[model samples]
Target: MVVERRSLIIDEREAASWIRDGMTIAIGGFINSSHPMAIVRQIIRRGVRDLTVIGPASGGLDLDLLIGAGCVRKLVTAYMGGEHYCPVAPMFRAAVERGELQVWECDEGMYYCALRAAAQRLPFTPWKAGIGTSFPDVNPEIKVFTDPIKGEPLLAVPAIRPDIALIYAAHADPYGNVQHIGTGFGDRALWRAADRTIVQVERIIPNEEVRKNPLATSLYGVDAIVRAPYGSHPFAAPGYYIEDAAHLREYVAAATAYAKHGDRGPFEAYLRKYVLEPETHADYLEVIGIKRLISLHEY
Candidate 1:
């Protein structure tokens, strides 16, 4: 078989353009950490609407920002909140409570299983997690059937196949091979499940360097790669920087103010300051300030 190689390097704006209206988009991260926030910001700035957003167990600023910007039509996830019980995701909670957003809730296992089914090209996966529970009651589409041999009912979860998936990585090559540090969470599965996968990396290393340690290259099937330092800002990228706790607190406060007082001022101001004003990811970093960013470095 002749190997085909494609140039995967792209800018943030181009990466955002890959997304269109009414697409099922999967974003990779756990809670607030390792999210592709830079690309998420670009997506918001472009004003893409009617997206069905999916993630693993939890999402923090990344998910909240998209929802707050009125980009999401539906959310399918296990949870959406801050890390370590810091604060509930104000925008997500507000939308759900007001019944403005359609939500499909599931446990982490069910969500992962659904993705796995999609990766394997299966119609659905069977699990016992939600059988005879309130999950089926809430999500009536989840079907249960009796196991032939075990004589026990198993829940059937439909495959979660996104039109595209966005993930952040510590390093990547021009060919789209990605290297992730720490627990990769559901990134690998998310990439495989999506029809297209885009990765935002801190930097691109030489292919030889990526080949030296094969174990670190856990990601495949990546469709595009963009070099994005501090791509996961406000969310920790292991070995690169610590989470910007102060900024996250500010975001939580802004969202809370908007939800409680019907004040869109703070949130809108945040959008202007972070997403709208910045022409590029470098511009966003400048707005974040060099001193603060330097302080966040793990080294």
Candidate 2:
């Protein structure tokens, strides 16, 4: 008897279709590194709306762009600022200040606890991190309960089960085995908390290559796999390229102008140039050009 090999490969557009309105989504990446920018841009282009977004522990423009594009109705995150590029993401700050976005405030520990609870299929996880903090004060969802064993106050971090997860990996086989070179930065936990996962990888390696170092396989049985070269463009991919600081500055400047002066001209112009007009991933990449991309490549 002969058996056919499994393949979960799909294109960026098809990957975006997996998401629906009002569903919660978990994005994987740290600050501006290894984000699935190609898939994100496609989702924006598809005009998906009313999304409840769960940003990474440390996120930047990836979340901001979604908010600015009017895709997110609610945001659950601990931080939404660029690490060193721009303290606060301009669009994210503007939306929150204008009362256009609903925020589910969580500290880092509380945020991770929620995901952990979901991953373990628990109702809620007991945490002491938010014991004396203002987290429960602002976000009533975090309930304060007495610990049964320790007889101490603890916060019940409700499970944050996402409908789907969008993650980036350095390599994945056709069978949906994902591998990463360096730290996955909470991506492992994030995917586990979701009902389904779509991974955007730089390369679709052979199954044999993935088995060569099985220990490096970060995730298995991914629902979908998209081969997106320079998928994290403008953001750094661990061992692939450095961030395009100049491009990031350009975006920050436009968004800041909109936030500071209500000048939508620059910000809208940016969306038109980068996100809206690009019909495909290749087109978006062409806008970045070869020379500039080559300059950012470290290896």
Candidate 3:
């Protein structure tokens, strides 16, 4: 008997359908790089609601966009901010301040360990990442236990097995094998920990080409793959492009106004112009203008 592999190529809309209301979603990225912004836009367009969003460390626009769109009911992350420049994520801060969003704050190291536990199919993992801090007090769900072997105190964080994982990469093949160029981040762990992994890439090449460089093919256990050029727009993709600082600044200003004034006007206008108006990612690229996007690309 011979085994056959199925192609996992899918469109952004179809990728959004894989996520349902109230499902736990893990997005791959650090603060401002390699985020699956295209899929996040699609999910907003689909009007998916009541989602539990998970970010590895701190997420920038990707998490803020979802929060602003009212798609996230709960956020599980180590930190939520605009890295160093933008200070705070306006939408996220607004929601939290208004008691509209629930947050499960985990230490960055503990968050990674929890995902690793999920990937290994374990119930929980023991580590000292959060034992000596106020995190254990604020988040009582994270328990402390005595290690049997060393007779030492350790903290246990539950495994985070998200219903779906959305990630962006530089390249992928038909069989869902993906390759990322720099700072791989927690993408690999997210891919393995989620029940379904949807990868958006800049390009889809032949499977033979993907296999040729086995080391570069760092991602596996992917369920779906979509081709989305400029997928991580406004955020850097290392060798592919630089961060769109101007656009980010614009967002920060708009979101801050909304948060401070309790007015939805500026944020709504921003959403309508950027997200709702564009029927597809291609349309978005066109709206961004070819010349402007090309200027951001790395030579």
lDDT of each: 0.87, 0.91, 0.86
TM-score, per-candidate, Cα-based:
0.96, 0.98, 0.95
Q: Which residue segments of model 1 deviate by more than 4 Å?
A: 1-5
Better of 2 and 3 by lDDT: 2
Residues 1-299, model 1: lDDT tens digits:
89876778999899999999999999998887899888899999899999999976666668988999999999888888886535678898888888888887788888887898999999888999877788877876577878888999998888989999999989999998899999888888789899999999998998999889988898965889989898899899988999998898888888888878888899999989988999899999999998999899775
On TM-score, the candidate that comes out on top is 2
Candidate 3: tens digits of C-alpha lDDT, residues 1-299: 99888989989989998989999999998888898888999999999999999886667777988999999999888878877647778899999999999888787888887888898999888988667888777777688899999999998888889999999898999998889988678888788889989999988989899889988997886899989999899788967898787878878888888889988888898898888999888988888888879889775
- Per-residue lDDT tens digits for candidate 2, residues 249-283, read 99899999988889988988888999999898999
TM-score of model 2 relative to the true fold?
0.98
- The list of candidate 2 runs beyond 4 A from truth reads none
lDDT of 1: 0.87
On TM-score, the stronger of 1 and 2 is 2
Ranking by TM-score: 2, 1, 3
RMSD of each: 2.1, 1.0, 1.8
Q: Give the 10-residue window scoring lowest on summed lDDT in candidate 3.
A: 79-88
Clashes of 2: 0
How far is 60's C-alpha from truth in model 1 (Å)? 1.8
